[model samples]
Target: MALRMKVTYLDGREEVVTILPPIFMAAEKHFKRDGGLSERNKVASTYYMTWQALQKFGREENDFDAFLELIEEIEDAEDEAEDPTGPAPQPDESSS
Candidate 1:
């Protein structure tokens, strides 16, 4: 089954993206195994990754390559917020 994500963009626009639940679960597992994310942050990270993956896949085929980039950006941002030493990675303009 697929999960849906309500995405709110910086431009004040909102949309829903559908993602396969297994993919989201895998991302969550990865975050937990990495040990870089807190308990709460790990959940949020999976959600963010799922949303980005859905958004990337929903768009044009060209966007597939940018999905990972967007995921990295979201993770980095979360890291920065939790730790000052961590700088937020910027999202790929091509995907955004």
Candidate 2:
């Protein structure tokens, strides 16, 4: 399955970025030299994937640190794509 995620920027723009093999290969190089992709390194995998997606998709080509600063949120495009709960229930206004 494609590793898809919704990337939201600080400027309020949101995009659905797909992580392809090129992105994974790059991450593999980086992590192999730094830390292997063990379960503990899941965050590293996620961030690298997001960064590469942003760059590869022409969304933002900044270096990783700069790209990190631009991201406001990261959500799974697959799981939340069909949120069964729907929107979070609003607080009851008549309670008090």
Candidate 3:
């Protein structure tokens, strides 16, 4: 599935930006490469990596501030997807 964000340009034009699953997966590896660094550095590195990755999908470099919102949305969705408690509980068959 693709995740998309709507950007409203300064000139009153609105456009939808999308990131496909492949790009997201590839970008994650680059983002994680700085895992050994301090939190501050990691945040900066992650933003840079995200910027670079999105650029490949046609996002403008000058619009990084808008991309920041998309990045946060993607990360939040990822966190929710990886959440263990998010799945439905299975039936217990212990008494069978």
Candidate 4:
């Protein structure tokens, strides 16, 4: 199954976009950084991912450094159309 991303912008918009191959490559390349999550690498990786998302789904085409500044967060997209918490259990009424 294809993975999806939940992109939250600083302006409070959340979009769930598919992580297809091309989009994923741009982010994954830098994400494989060997520095073990240094603060600098973290920022860089976030920049790349946000930029790639903007290029793919957004109207941006050039260097999206400024757009990266507008992102709040990015993470795996959960199924918003369904209840992930599931339903509560039912009691046995046949004992009555």
Candidate 5:
């Protein structure tokens, strides 16, 4: 499954990109490895994953630091989206 996420760059720019399954899987593996998500590994995986995902969409990111920043924001956004804060109640609009 491809994960479509909006990434915000350090320059305050935003982009919607779909991360392919292979890249996502590889990043997941690296994130959940034996060391349990070290900073170095996380940065590496995010950078590589972002690079691959962008390339798949015909985008190029040359600044390593900027790429790292963008991926970190993407990760943060992903975490927020996956928060188990309970689902919101639906409105009863049927009577309208």
Candidate 6:
């Protein structure tokens, strides 16, 4: 799935643009490469890189719903791989 960013101009105009996931994935890989850094620092650096890249691509904000879905999918896939019998987590009722 393509990672998308919503760009809003100074004049209040907005547009959605695709940002290659590999870019963010690369930042994560880099963070993992250096195990010496504190976990907080690694996570912060990765997110910082993500934001910088979004700005470089002219994105104003992230599509939070899509991001959450992506995270859920990844977690589900990992769970399936690790334990086939594991049930997926239920969505929060309050969110509905």
* CA-lDDT, candidates in order: 0.51, 0.79, 0.51, 0.64, 0.63, 0.46
Residue range 1-96, candidate 2, lDDT tens digits? 468888888999887778887887777787896665557777768887888887887887799888789888777787546355769988999988
Top candidate when judged by lDDT against the true structure: 2
Clashing pairs in 5: none
lDDT of 5 at 44: 66
Model 4 compared with the native: what TM-score?
0.51
Off by over 4 Å in 3: 34-54, 57-96
lDDT of 6 by residue, 12-69 (tens): 5534444356665656666675653356675455344445455556653555344333
Better of 2 and 5 by lDDT: 2
Candidate with maximal TM-score:
2
TM-score per model over all chains: 0.40, 0.71, 0.36, 0.51, 0.46, 0.28
Considering summed lDDT, which 10 consecutive residues are worst modelled in model 2? Answer: 77-86
Model 3's lDDT to the true fold? Answer: 0.51
> How many collisions per candidate?
0, 0, 0, 0, 0, 0
Model 5 deviation from the true structure expressed as Cα RMSD, one decimal place: 8.2
TM-score, cand. 5 vs. native:
0.46
Model 6, residue 62: distance off in Å is: 18
Model 3: residue 61 alpha-carbon error in angstroms = 5.5
Candidate 4 yields a Cα-based lDDT of 0.64
RMSD of 1: 14.7
Q: Give the residue spans of candidate 1 off by over 4 A.
A: 34-39, 60-96
| Candidate 6, pairs of clashing residues | none
